[model samples]
Target: MADGEPPKPPPRLEESVKQSQLSPQILYSDVVKAHSQPYSQQPFELNTIFDAESSALKEISTYQGKPSVVFPFSDKQVLVEKLKYVLVGKFSHGRPPMDTIKKFFVSLKLKGDCNSTIFDKKHIFIECVCKEDYYHIWLKLKWFIDGYAMRVFKWSPDFSPMKESSIAPVWIRVECLPLYLFDEMSLLSISNSIGRPISVDPRNINRTMLHSSRICVELDVDKPLLDAILISFKDEVSKNILEKFWVKVFYDEVPLFCSFCCHIGHGTGTCKRRLEDIRSGQGKAEILSADKVFDNMPQAENSTNSTKFVAGNCGSKMGKQIRPSMEWQPIGKHVPNARSDLDNKVAPE
Candidate 1:
């Protein structure tokens, strides 16, 4: 009690508590390390190509691993240029007079430069820069070529794709048509068998051409589908009927694309499959048969005018024609003909 000494300072509570609680602990996990080699020098490849051909077993194996698909929109713009268009018929004995061909293409504005046209021995190939230009050249040269007929086919790796004779409705001349077949009902049935009947010559029901056996029918069908139907019809008739009524598919000098393949720049005559058939003696020798062209029409939306027209409700005016009765008539019976003198502003004497 009598000792002189300095008093000791009290211990800090926070430091003492922290020191007591502190302890070393270990954590464990699988770690992935970067490879020693650079990415370009890596030994492994991401994609693998299998040599095995497709079969039921192969399909079953890959079924679970299939990637999610994105369906293309129907109206999606085709990114690739439709560069090729074909010119059929003999342009010249040798290399087609390139000068004349170039002038023709330049005149049509299809090809601005001489380099765009490539001449083959049997056909001339014109390179169109865009789809629109390709289509324009196709339509322009289809029917009215003076010396050489033009046929535009779809581009394909192995062969030309099947297409219509023309974008417009095809006209088929039915020769040796019996008097009985000239009736509206019969004609309509025939047209329906082929495609949507656009019109029969002398569309007026009263003024139907009874005297002439030949009937010219305009069908709202691409040439290929119509040709297939015609061939089938002709074959069926050939077996039963004695009178060989020739059904002339009027391509009118325009060449047709091969029905076997859906290409635009070549005809069935030049098709590899067709040539092979020819070599094997399986090719058709008769000129009466139309070259089978269409396997199927392009899938179209209801938005197009052609489809709307085929649906028979093209315009707002057709609404009035819808009657409560079963019968349907597009043209009125009592309407005066615009071509007649009575309706003309200046009556012809």
Candidate 2:
């Protein structure tokens, strides 16, 4: 062909096929052998085999399959508007009443405007105008429900089940754990009493750190449970006699792990739970037992056979360290920075 003239259209399909008939073909067995090595033992760089552009395009196309539609908004509207989440599980046999679900979410008065519709027998589509509202509901509902065996998931147009990993246990340093809680089982019992999944960290198992008043604990419980435990301990150490047995509970303000999923480099706000909430809702959370610390108490190894008591006058102010009435406030509100010296306090008869 002349330089100025465009080459004629490629030969007909039949001619091209005939000309390339002798080309060698890669056998399926050869392809299989090429990739037979374990992924870890593979010699080639893993990234080399991955086609980034093609893979990205494939994902984009998959997402585009059932793209979300944005409804037209009024000109006066100033907000970005609402998004929906799909809650799924083996639900009741028929469609759940929409009014009841809507009323339930609204009663919570979560951060957003909430609405619900029966997506199907097994799925409920919940919509919240505010992202915060959408999240709060997911976190609270993921763990337990009154009587329903169901899970909360993000509403996906493609209707695929959301895939999410469970939140992992977080390691937290607990300060002023009572010195009396010496054994692992005792500590575990007390830890479990807070109505959450917790354990004495294995690192503290063999090490003799109970000599110090602080220890590390790993928790898989929800945030509310942790707060409740803190509040409970606060109440315990307020009274004079009870205070002698309990220590002020203090949690590490700066944690190495994510407060949400208990992973590093993140906080509860940016946790995997939220990520899962925005994608597919997480799986069923493990339910914690209602047992409290004192309920299933670990027996003391050594016991005193006999006890001697020194009686004191009921109205005697002889050995009391009288503090100002203002200092007698609730433990939850006012806590001393240092442990109080209860040795000087008057002993009850």
Candidate 3:
């Protein structure tokens, strides 16, 4: 049985499972290969995008049956450096100052440093800045743009894929892009000027886009009007006529009585001027005033005192006069003010 020959060991699993560089997988394969190799060793070129002068983008795009998503970028050297940093590394320090970025670039101007936008995201209908010659830069940064798109929106950027903006997530549309993107010059001038320049990538929406165009992004919002609509939408009995009621008839800058009574007519019985008017025969008042003239006011009846004081129930002493209030009973059944009047009448002066 010819068993003398030594059998070769099984091939290394490392070689068997080794990944590939290209099968026309487009940006995905590029990232797979780039990440497969150490980030420290992968070209790390910040200047020119990979294969800027080749039709490789078209071939790879066709191989995957996807179109190239164009991204517009600014000519500002600051954006170029920032974009370079994003391409070569992650966005550290979050949002840094444009001046600081520009200052850095001005200090260390790199050779052939072309400005590229981080549209790292694209959707169906192929979002882009409607800027002049945007297509030029778009074709240049095709790989990075598509890679960013995959990393951001969680799906490949597709023009006329399946759904339109009318079908996208509400938070993705209203809050994210137009509202946030309109404010960032990085997106406004470089990315498309749609309602929300801020966009979720078709591939991965987590990776944020650093640059966009302001021309198409309509970020302006009528906040007051929008709030009004929301308020109306949240309409309830709270906004009803009786009182713009909060928890228990809450009051504002206006006086408590005035606010409750709509600030126009008479207030609570605590009104002092109304009491005087009732005494002067201007109107027949129902609620008796604390300062009313009492028949039991023999004490201060002829006395030359404009008013005398009488202690009330809760330390809130009321003004004493010839007239007595019938509406409010004293703390005790007996009238304390009456007793005071009796004592005052008996005393001289």
Candidate 4:
């Protein structure tokens, strides 16, 4: 109020708020004091409390719980059995229209009616009405439709759309196998060295053809397939001498093989592992050259007119000469002397 005296400073916001409520320390002390003043109470019966809880749980379980519906085991088995006759097909490079695939099958003039359905927009689920058609479609393993390779797989109970089939039935021609080994047992044993033998060509069973034996084998696509096998047999001229014969194997309609990962369904160019290595600044993974992997196998010549020599005289002498250019033709091309029994069964009508 005096002229020389400064006006009293306004109360601070914090001081104003503090004046309205008790301090935190006082509040905490009061809470502790309250909790420390324990009062006596009558003891409760444990059995009564447990009984009440049990009654509540029973009511909730009986009234609020939902009943689970389980699928019948017999029905599941029947469904799986029906699925056994189904085959799934996927194009290796691209997915063609469903109508185009259906038309292609019709052109083949399949033995029985096959109901084709699109599976996951990427595969074709083929349900064959008759068992004959099912085997016919599945046995071929790969079909060329419009120059695209259509890989067929048998539908199993554990079939998944996200995963690719790593096992396929591949028809392999075992060349350079001596005429003596054309018998069923010998052919089976040789094919077993490559994969699990499924069936031998009908011609091989009758010994009608001696040049090469064809056998269908279930090959694991994840493993590196053998291009040739070495068979050690006692020399016919000398009982004490053992000779090694390298039998060359040729696979028909095998899917893309990856040398980087040594797996099928993908090639080294598209290998995920190689891409990861490159992305991480590690450069490309060391890919094993085909020559290094199959050291003893016969290598194809670079010349257009190169000829493959047959095994003879302990793999020293060439018994027959095969034109390498014509031997491994691209898919969908008809060879001059291709077998008509199975390979060319699905001719366009």
Candidate 4: what lDDT?
0.64
How does each model score on TM-score? Answer: 0.27, 0.25, 0.12, 0.45
Alpha carbon lDDT of each predicted model:
0.38, 0.41, 0.28, 0.64
- Clash list (residue pairs), candidate 2: 85-155, 86-154, 86-155
lDDT of 3 by residue, 110-179 (tens): 4334233332222211222233223322222222321232111111223122221111111122121222
Better of 2 and 4 by TM-score: 4
lDDT of 1 by residue, 234-333 (tens): 2474564222112222323223445544343455556686667667777466311434222223222111222111111222331121122212111112
The TM-score obtained by model 3 is: 0.12
Best by TM-score: 4
Could you report the Cα RMSD, in angstroms, for every candidate shown?
23.3, 23.0, 32.5, 22.7
How are the candidates ranked when ordered by TM-score, highest leading?
4, 1, 2, 3
Instruction: Report the candidate with higher TM-score, 2 versus 3.
Output: 2
Instruction: List model 2 lDDT by residue over 95-143, tens digit each.
Output: 4466766666767877656667665566666667775665555543342
Superposition error at 218 for model 3 (Å): 4.2
